[model samples]
Target: MTMFSTIRLRAAAVLASFALALSGCFLSPGKFTSELVFTGPDSFTFSYEGEIFFLGLSKLAQMDAAQAEFTPPECYNQETYESQECSAEELADARANWESGAADRAAEAKKKAEQMAAMMGGIDPSDPKAAEELVKRLKRQKGWERVVHKGDGVFDVSYRVTGTMGHDFMFPLIEGFPATNPFVQTFVRQGGQVRINAPGFATQNPEQAGMGAMMGIGSLAGLAAMRAELDGQGDAMPGIPVIDGTFTVRTTRGMRVLANNTDEGPEPNNTGEALTWRITTRTAQAPTALIALIP
Candidate 1:
């Protein structure tokens, strides 16, 4: 597999794990509320407040184990997986088995850790310090300043990125793995306004894109089932994992939205100042939701 394909496969595995963990639950992973307040033509205050639900204690343990087992290769560590001399076959195998291997390895590690914990009289799930090490690991990133356990399988985290917006700002929801799953909610600035470009997942790989199109068609079929279930026209189909979120943009005082591709969220106010794009279900759509603003 090519480097890009490897990256895409890695991302798919992580997302698949997330979906399984959040399946059948009302809370899907976590809710993110972010604000991008433009301070100048080229600068902004990026604040994000969110929580990531672990679902169960075992899930947390599994995540820790998976992270330990899957340390990125030296080439990946240097952000040059494509150019490095790493064995392509090794990378291909890793990608092929990442999902199942992650689960199996995590289960084995969890079993061993459980045995040790039993001998040590077990660790309290409610112990704040239990998650401290993981929090520290997460905070090692440049913009992540705070990551705290907020009780009940939830983690309260916040981060800020401040500077002139370069070509684009990418916030990797999952990093350190083969594919850094960065979510780019903001686009290149164009004369006092920012554009919302296509999401990376939509174009990560041609094969994946084609697969996504097929999945989208499947989702439409699922949607029909959902409507039928609501109307008592048919039985409910298996649920598709739907990742949902909202992106809010606040331009400088005098700026306003110029154009948008989505009508899911409220339109720019009469003052033409701000807009929010609500991503209801980011399963297989193009993933590109554009919005341009201008002063």
Candidate 2:
């Protein structure tokens, strides 16, 4: 019974949590080139030129509902570990557990949806108007040079920012969004240590991506089933974009990189050292670097 109660939406969580785990739940990158440069310990410049994909209205509108609804685990399945030859009492107990959990699931879903709505200007990405509002909201910000909706929740845009690393930094820091899951995260630690990660760039690694790699979809059948289970139909939704891009980081001399996953590591650049990662649908880990500056 302990295991049965927690199995709600196990396989489906992969698809649903793909974007949901992103925490932002609104925007993720499709294809782009992003870069971060440190002129000095307290100074930096960052830019991203690429596509921002919206998965809520376009690819995963049923995610919340899918998460909320529990499909009964079939016992005696050959492929899955969920079920086996069950006695009548076990079956009855499972049914009772399922029935009891329904109200809990519904309540949790409602609470989560409400919290997301509060953060997102009272609108979730599943709404058609979300795309327009996103563009407008981004345009109102100083860094967003272009914000054009290309249909199906994809946007073509350019962004650039220059600031001091005296404090931490993050990209796609929407005014009304969650801060925990920035596409780009920069943390300034004590003793001039700096850490960075591009959570949105990695497309296909399970460690980084909850769904298909990063935010890339793994299976249409899975999507259809989750959607059908929640939206009452299993038809596939189209126009899901691929993820492809390059990320580069340049640091001035005297900076020592502590950890990273770049080909050939950090190569000598005009300013100092540079790290680069090419992103694709097969790309699993995004760009990450921890550097110690001359203090």
Candidate 3:
């Protein structure tokens, strides 16, 4: 449900991370309630019941058709490093150059989209039945309990995934879709430790932000370059639906919750403690935690 700078429609895919700026983009969240509950050191249950927005099927993909008013290119002095007024001839040349490349850019964008479509279960975004095909694919999967195409790349659905933490895990993972940046994650570590980070659910996660900086993806707007386009709650992008929800992490007693950003920290439950994050459009830091699981 998001992308990158100026979002050259050609490269955006969920049909764009498993919705990265690359070919396998991940879906953006709409309104919903989700939770991650840890019953034991080696097991967990994660469920997402809400709306997921697909970029290829949304107004975003049509951005190419929305041409902007051309602005005269500025001329700068190379030697003195100062701004200079452009000659009428220079302006004409610039306009001519940009106009000449419009068709090429549009074509490249379409080709990129088609390439993405091939990996996205082979259903073209241009096809009227694309959304229905997507629904069928999700229905055929194991965790996608319900999927309803609401048109324009949006779907109302319920998804639940559970498994032992012997290995890493990702959510909203389709049968044939290549894995990109996931909406949620649970990674098992060396000493019965587990990590939880949901970049898609948040505007930005602190650790990933630092990593993004190191990787040259400096958008504080979120996890990757594409997240800036989605902006989690869609504050930066107005047309997209609001991303509002709750992520509750419940763990068994004695499980050490080492790190988190919950408003009041973890709360007590019958067997253990509960950590809750009240996600909103303005959620600056993505929800995260490091818990050393109890054996």
> How much is the lDDT of residue 180 in candidate 1?
23
TM-score per candidate, in order? 0.45, 0.66, 0.71
User: What TM-score would candidate 3 get against the native?
Assistant: 0.71
Off by over 4 Å in 3: 1-20, 23-26, 66-99, 204-238
Higher lDDT: candidate 1 or 2?
A: 2
Put down candidate 3 lDDT per residue, 60-148, tens digits, no spaces.
56555444445576575666646678778878887888798888767867775776586575778778887888889899888899898
Mind giving the per-residue lDDT tens digits that candidate 1 earns over 1-295?
Answer: 2343444453344334333322222122244666566666677777666754433332432444446555434343335344555577766666666656767766765564554333222443334565564566568876787788765445767878786766666554434222222345566755644665434222122244432332221232222223233345332322322234555665655554556554554344543345565544333333343334344
lDDT of 3 at 170: 81
lDDT of each: 0.46, 0.67, 0.67
Comparing 1 and 3 on lDDT, the stronger one: 3
Off by over 4 Å in 2: 1-26, 62-116, 124-128, 203-237
